[model samples]
Target: MISKIYSSSSIYFSTDDKIDFFGPKCTREPSYNYKLSGKQDGDGGFWNTFYELDFYIIHNCTNHGAKMRQIRRNTQYAPASALFVEIKPWNSSITNQGQETAEFF
Candidate 1:
């Protein structure tokens, strides 16, 4: 799993000047191969962190093969400082579980 830690000082802004962490355009490319996991961490604790998984498209172009999981931490105390993601599938066989798995930081 790929893990990243963000401090509480980073300034994130949207194209519309709106303040956001994940912003409104955070999503996987459709033409590319990938699948996103669920939102795992939301507890207001020192160990809070966000996690997700991406499954790369295989040679067949119809199935997902290689996969990678990413984890990140909140950089600010904003109420909207939560994890957000979108999953894109190459085909319709892939399904969304809509479940998050949390772990200590």
Candidate 2:
């Protein structure tokens, strides 16, 4: 299936437990517009600029199987940066077959 892309629009994210990609916000989600501001409270973090590069934050709306949408934003957005990615070392002795570290569990 071909999903339409909003290349001219911006993106945002909600870290609040009460918010999501779809739900009450989804209805509020625009069909042809975007919100990209951190000016007002509860506007979600408008970190990334709209349509900057090919960068996008997408999520599958709740109860919408096999469908996904990108997080949208308004005009006043916050500039953000990816600080670092956390990497965890793989423990072969604990996870490998027959290594058997059941006592830790």
Candidate 3:
């Protein structure tokens, strides 16, 4: 995914502007964490703490695997861009059922 972003454009983050919260800095190469593209705390932060619930997310866990993703649309900058994601779990087992699972979070 990161490769695709860099291959498509020249908007990669610079060494001086690289985000190092995840690891060593000095991004001589383009990297992606998408989180690094935005603030992670306070106002305007990614997943803005002010309106956490405003960003809707869905997590589905099943016998195959688990998926967690968020969708944001109709924002100030972009007219219509949707961000979706999925995950393949290595190991997982059902811990709750139906309504009980929803209430836990």
Clashing pairs in 3: none
Tell me the TM-score of each prediction against the true structure.
0.18, 0.20, 0.16
Candidate lDDT values, in order: 0.29, 0.26, 0.23
lDDT of 2 by residue, 1-103 (tens): 1111222233244222111121222332324233221212222245433222221234443343424444322222232332322212222211111211212
* lDDT score at residue 70, model 3, on the 0-100 scale: 24
Please name the candidate that would achieve the greatest lDDT relative to the true structure: 1
- The lDDT ranking, best first, is 1, 2, 3
Worst 10-residue stretch by lDDT in candidate 1? 14-23
Writing each residue's lDDT as its tens digit, candidate 1 over 8-32 gives 3222441111122221222244433
RMSD, candidate 1, Å = 14.5
Pick by TM-score: 2 or 3, better one: 2
